[model samples]
Target: MTATSASTTSAGPAGVDVAQFADVTASDASLRRFLHGLPGVDQVGCEARAAGLGTRSIKTTAKAQALDLAIRMVDLTTLEGMDTPGKVRALASKAMRPDPADPTCPAAAAVCVYPDMVATAKDALGDSGVHVAAVATAFPSGRAALDIKLADTRDAVEAGADEIDMVIDRGAFLTGRYLQVFEEIVAVREACARPDGTAAHLKVIFETGELQTYDNVRRASWLAMMAGGDFIKTSTGKVQPAATLPVTLVMLEAVRDFRAQTGRMVGVKPAGGIRTAKDAIKYLVMVNEVVGQDWLDPDWFRFGASTLLNDLLMQRTKMTTGRYSGPDYFTLD
Candidate 1:
């Protein structure tokens, strides 16, 4: 198919325009048919491609640029049950000033927190270029009523969340209730619009680990994109197998194809398990080769991590000083 420029107003895959989700979601069979009809994923080929890309050489200046880009693309997160205002304040401070010693470092893309901490994070973040992103819609499990989920999203947006990371109802998705999941995403997307009308971007998390198959991941990626996801994320970081190279490769291909088909570019975030500067640089290499340089920007991509920052900083220090810096040198947070 010849690629057509994507307009929120135009009809999407299976003739379901984002605005017409309510109508399209009226039939369960239609939703299932649409999802299952998507192209199948070649598991071996995908994994092999990702592994090969991981071997690409990124040395000297290019490596430094990739490290900085990865640092800027991080969603510095702390989502524990024991989270407190003080904890969030400290995290937000660290996010704003990732490297107090080196003013050259860029701020993280956002500081992710629970809906209740949005205001605290916003306050702590102040006028810093960093954004406040809140996880909502019963994140991690996404097993809540539509009304409650929408309310959760609204609460965060009202509290000044510039972005919302929401998890899909994995149970519903796995049970073949595609329409229900599709409608839920549509509802959350509607809820993300602020009162003044400028809206927070919505990232739909698939938790690919639970989805259990590459085909499911591919289908979910398309489902979220068609439902108006600004970014299709890999996991919630609460799962055992949060993010991995093959899963990220699949998601990258999904976004690339979605843009090719609809002419709209959505971002991708591979949360969880990305801990080292080497790991991050590998992902950068995948993005650069798989989808080209267009998706390299922080706006178009993000890494949902906290520890990954320190590693990147350490490697960056090593690159600059010609020696590796100990973990003690970086802020603990």
Candidate 2:
């Protein structure tokens, strides 16, 4: 697949050039044509590539380093309805110190929770360098009206969330109402801004399982980036087949191509269904191979997970002390 170039100088939201993509998002037809015209995924080839990369192994010192990097790249998430302020505080504490036994262990990239929990998380993680991320736009369902969605985003931002993860209207996108989805993302991105001028970073969740095909994943990635999303995320962790290796591969390719085409970089987050340290390592390998070192940092790539941290801690302990620690040693998420 080749990167498509857009030429126009005017600036748009999130530093994107609006005029550059003006022709593409001019209307529903134009947006659909552009998204459809993009390269299609070769399912066999894509899955094959993911499988091959998954087999690449790290060992000894390299394995230890990979474990540390993976720990830092985690967005320690807890989105259950039963979540309490105390639970969020505990989660935030864990995010700041994943392995309390080992002070050398790196803190996670963020503590993700519902909008109502952002303030609790913020208070728990004050001045810790770890970010507070809130899932908005009606979260797992993204079924609310645009006004409600924007208000959700504003609530999170106002509550001191450093990042906002908004779900797109997959219903609209699937029905070929690409313009509607695009506009909603743009609006939410706007709502992430604080009164102090610096805005919470926006992570657009496509809930890729609902998107169905790899080709649609690519289309959604581009649409979110074009609409000023700082990051394009895979799932909401509430659906089947969340964040598969092949699907993430497609998204990695999209961000890589997008940066090449527009000179703007967007982050990718693969959420849910990734539980083991080994599984996280495979994703790290894929990111290295697919997009190179540029996306190796937490700022560019994050694993949206709750249970993955425990396994990583276990692996770290085993590597450090030459013995395996049972899962009981770590606090459950």
Candidate 3:
């Protein structure tokens, strides 16, 4: 590999040691509470658990709270901003509909929306405690100029996005220009800052699956963290193999190690392709096993899922009320 000079020379500032951040302990009650508070997760995650048991494949790993926490870690929200204006209006209307069993619940994080719809989300969430996140930096491609990217981020924040997700140019990162990616992330992170000087949380999407290997994943994770990624996300869910376990495992370890070295608590977001309760739980178990549990909170973890919420609600209904519900009961529409 191409070991660039700046990455070697820059060790970050005083007490802000990136190397000391990954050592935090895992497993805790706080993480548990944060996850259980979420609205949906039963459709796929719990369905996976039930399906596995029905087939007698494996039923021993059912840690409800852990699984629940995993489900809660999910951002059951969606992307209404990508589609046409008609689609956006339809989705906004769907957001207004109430579920008899599940109701309109707050997701793990705010739904990721286009900048124009930020106000709709803010009004929809209405201080419900769920974050209102927006994608910035020429999302899904990030091929725009830096100034435009920064302007987009500012607009989203002004429109009421609580978190801003910015994409780095994969072209630059892949060609071995680590500094370019680093500078862009730092600039975008700065762009996300609030008026009080405290920046809105920034989740940097590495689109790890697009990268070649685990080593590249590790390297990119390091670069993003070093540049100030509040959360290291896996994909935009726009690409294939969005949130594979192996890739997520690598990211989890990177965060764990980073914490051990820097004392900073960076979060991990395994977005895209995660559809079931079992998948959600596996992610949780992996986090507990690999990162130790301290990273389980919504603050340190989140799943970008449009389908997971239904599965979670179904499971809860089955356990409490003992009946399976239709998908219509859980979906946004």
Top TM-score: which candidate number? Answer: 2
Clashing pairs in 1: none
Better of 1 and 2 by TM-score: 2
Clashes of each: 0, 0, 39
lDDT of 2 by residue, 44-87 (tens): 99999999999999999999999999999999999998999999
Query: Which sections of candidate 3 miss by over 4 Å?
Result: 1-62, 80-107
Q: Which stretches of candidate 1 lie over 4 Å from their true place?
A: 1-17, 20-26
**Each model's lDDT:** 0.87, 0.91, 0.68
Give the Cα error of residue 288 in candidate 2, in Å: 0.3
Instruction: Residues 1-333, candidate 3: write the lDDT tens digits.
Output: 122343433333222233322221012232223223323323355345434433332233364565456555765445644555555444443333323444533335446677777777777667557677788888888899999999999999888888888887989878766666767887787777677656678899988778866666766777787677889999988988787777777677778876775567789998898877767777777777678768878888998877776676666556555577777666552
> Candidate 2: deviation at residue 274, Å?
0.4
Worst 10 residues of 1 by lDDT: 1-10
Q: lDDT tens string, model 1, 92-179? A: 9888878888889878889999999999999999999899999999887888888899999999999999999999999989999887
